[model samples]
Target: MFGVLVVRLPEGRLGFLRAFSGMLAGRWDVEGYVPPLFDREARASLEPQGEATVKALFARAEAMRASPELLTLRAAHAEQSARHASEIVALRERHEVRRKQRHARRAELTEAASKSSTPEASAHAAELRDSLHALDQESRGDKAERRRLEATHASERSSLEPKLLRLERRLRALDRLRHMVSRAVMRRIHDTYVITNARGERRLLRSLYERAQPPSGAADCAAPKLLAYAQAHGLRPVALAEFWWGAPPPSGGRVTGAYYAACRDKCGPLLPFMLDGLFVARPRTFTPPSTTPGSLSILFEDRWLVVVAKPHGLLSVPGREASLSDSVLTRLKARYPDATGPLLVHRLDLDTSGLLVAALDARTHSALQRQFVHREVHKRYVAWVDGIVTGEQGRIDFPMRVDLDDRPRQIHDPIHGKPAVTEWRVIERRGDRTRVAFFPLTGRTHQLRVHAAHPLGLGAPIVGDRLYGRDGERLMLHAESLTLLHPGTGERVTFDSPVPF
Candidate 1:
């Protein structure tokens, strides 16, 4: 990604800083671009040493694999194996022919003995039986010969194996050494990164990722480079924007010239640390989906389960962070202290308001979860899209995957994406907006939201979608109703929540 930061000088003059995410055309220090967050001199020395050793090791391994002595031994063994197999087959075929001939002769002798009517018939039969015994002895001799041939071949083949095995062992050792050397080099390279926050607090880049190895190009994202430079140079950042400027990978869904959010994997951890001293006001704050906030809107409850009209901005389950402890699951756990099993059966997007189900016991939870997994549960979502949809009803089938760059944002990717299907029908068309109901056939993260916003789907962003389109008072989407089989009663049940826009 490429980024530009609108900056304010100490003298109150305005200027902008430009930065690219990582190396542009294999050069880290471009003429006018801000430098990366690493020690250049340290890398200059460390990278070459590691690269040279890795290359040399690879070259040696490749040479050893193609050595003539090894190849010749392998060829000799293969050729001998084929010859032995052919010889054994020929010997078996000959024995088979001899056995068939002996059988035909015995049949002819038996027929002649049966036709004879006198004493010669009995004597002839005895002679024929004796001949059959001789043939059985010949068959045993052939079997012995076949076993002897196989043993000889095995002994001959073993002769060349010791040399071949020794050569391969050397190659395997080289591969292990190469891997160790490469890992050592990368570890040192990570150590060279010295990242700083706005508070001027310094830390190693790898430290931000904790025990995990920082992903490749960890401190090299456009956000970090721009913010880090601004912090270092005493420039105050007023505004920032990042956009894709080049061809995206074939498996990627990024569009050239399209603005993008900061990548979560590389920048998610770094940005929070870097923006420590900045008063970064979020574009929008969580607003209640209904008239009330922090109060549970229990739609239905029974001995086995409970369904709540989850307000928007409330997480379906408690978040990992301590700050995000307020959620539907947390509230339920507080109320039903004796509730057994994981209370949550399914989840809704944090910004989506809708009917959410929770089982009071483990058996109910398991059964309810099965309904969702098998697509037996039905959900209806009410949404007001920014654009007036042209059709009355249609199914949107855009396969989706999480945008690796941005958390919680999805992109259309048929190749490396899960299937997300939505059946929708227009309820009302209001000037430039359309109110619609969406029935999702599959449950994925941000499924309904993405199906509404993606160009391949409805070609319209849900009104007030901050991530997909523009920010507003709240995301104009709600889980209006949910239908599922009651685990306790063995009957179908439906729950409804008023659509709050």
Candidate 2:
């Protein structure tokens, strides 16, 4: 069996050897790792004054906004706009009230005429109708007079219009100037060629930014920086990986050791150039020869629902590839062909083995899903992480958002992230490894793993978590227990699964 291995190289393309003992053999180099965000050099380089030219550009923009003429123009525009708004509101209200009154009188007269029948009553109604017609003419005349007055008022205030337009034009010009300077500073600071080893094959930073169209601070993330360092050092990227270190940034979602994919909006475009000459392996896609019947463990079942234990490495539902069609739902469907509604109410990560509650009908599925969304469902996971725990128990409150540069992988974003919280209690400590129970209050992607690894949370990456930590046989995380309200009985129900690790 192949075991985990690490190889180090000074620089160059990875070498491959074929037909080795009936298997392909290859010597591959890792894409390279980037130091944590808080690395001393990285932090120092981020100082605002690191580039004097950029600093000066920003200062110049600020100075432009402080000009005397611009300030006067701004104040004058604000006053004129406010005064005009008040006058317009008054004029509109007066006209609207008069129009409504006229319409109401017309309606009342029409209704009375519709009800009249006797000769005398009809004659009187006819007279009243004539009067109403006369009133309608007068109302029309009133509307025309109102419009003329409004037109005159507008003409009287026409002087301010040109001044306002001129002021707007000037303000827009100033804004454009400021924007240009800011863009230049950002380009100088963020768009500089950092990845040197791309064999000059990679696109320039500015070109990448233009193509990717990422958010303001996206290009400066650790992934692209790490790739830049590797290229500069003449290292050929074989495989790339990143991890979170330090306390969760002001926002939350990152765990200390969980592996995360490169961001999409930020790193997606840049990585293609970085990996230009690398021979990366295509991801494997295959189905096992067979699965034993006992592999589909059923903990609880009834007419409406079934709580099945999902084995690790097995998908909860069919994957994108038809070759990966064998899954818990597909297997269950073979046995219970009549099962209706959404078969699975909630899902566990493909790597996480757990007790999954599946609903047999649509109503039951919707009910269970509602409970999950409202945070009424409770979940607990057991994990063995690569660190010793000093704290007895604590809660991790971190905001999480999908990193635009790296898709699927989440990041800590304080300004624009959803709140994620997890509570943990240490089960035991074994030298460098610590076992803990995780109580996730919010269901975010990789919530438990991040909480376990983020410095602010547990400060330890989970053992065997290939994504967040070192590679191993499997991630040492298990969904130990789940608690939810039963869809059928409306009673609180909890299920437990023995931790495999």
Query: Which one is best on lDDT?
Result: 1
Clash count for each candidate, listed in order shown: 1, 28
List TM-score per model, in order. 0.55, 0.59
How large is the C-alpha RMSD of every model relative to the true structure? 10.6, 9.7
Q: Give the alpha carbon lDDT tens digit for every residue of 1-501 in model 2.
A: 111112224644353211101111232122232322123454346545545644665566567568676677667667866776786687679767877887888888778877888778968777887978887787788678767766766775575566656756765676676577656555554544444335576454556656434456454555555555555545555555555554454434444545555556666666676666666567444453344323879999998899888887777888887777878888889877998876988777666777888888888889889988999999989999888977889999988777665455566677787999999999998888999999988889877876776666777878866545565666788888999989789789899999988
Q: Please, what are the lDDT tens digits per residue for candidate 1 over residues 272-373? A: 998888889785533435434447788889899999887778877776767677889999999899999999999887778888999999999999999999
Alpha carbon deviation, residue 140, candidate 2 (Å): 23
lDDT of 2: 0.68
Best by TM-score: 2
Off by more than 4 A, model 2: 1-176, 185-294
Model 2: weakest 10-residue lDDT segment is: 16-25
lDDT of 1: 0.84
Report lDDT (CA) for all predictions: 0.84, 0.68
Superposed Cα deviation of residue 151, candidate 2 (Å):
21
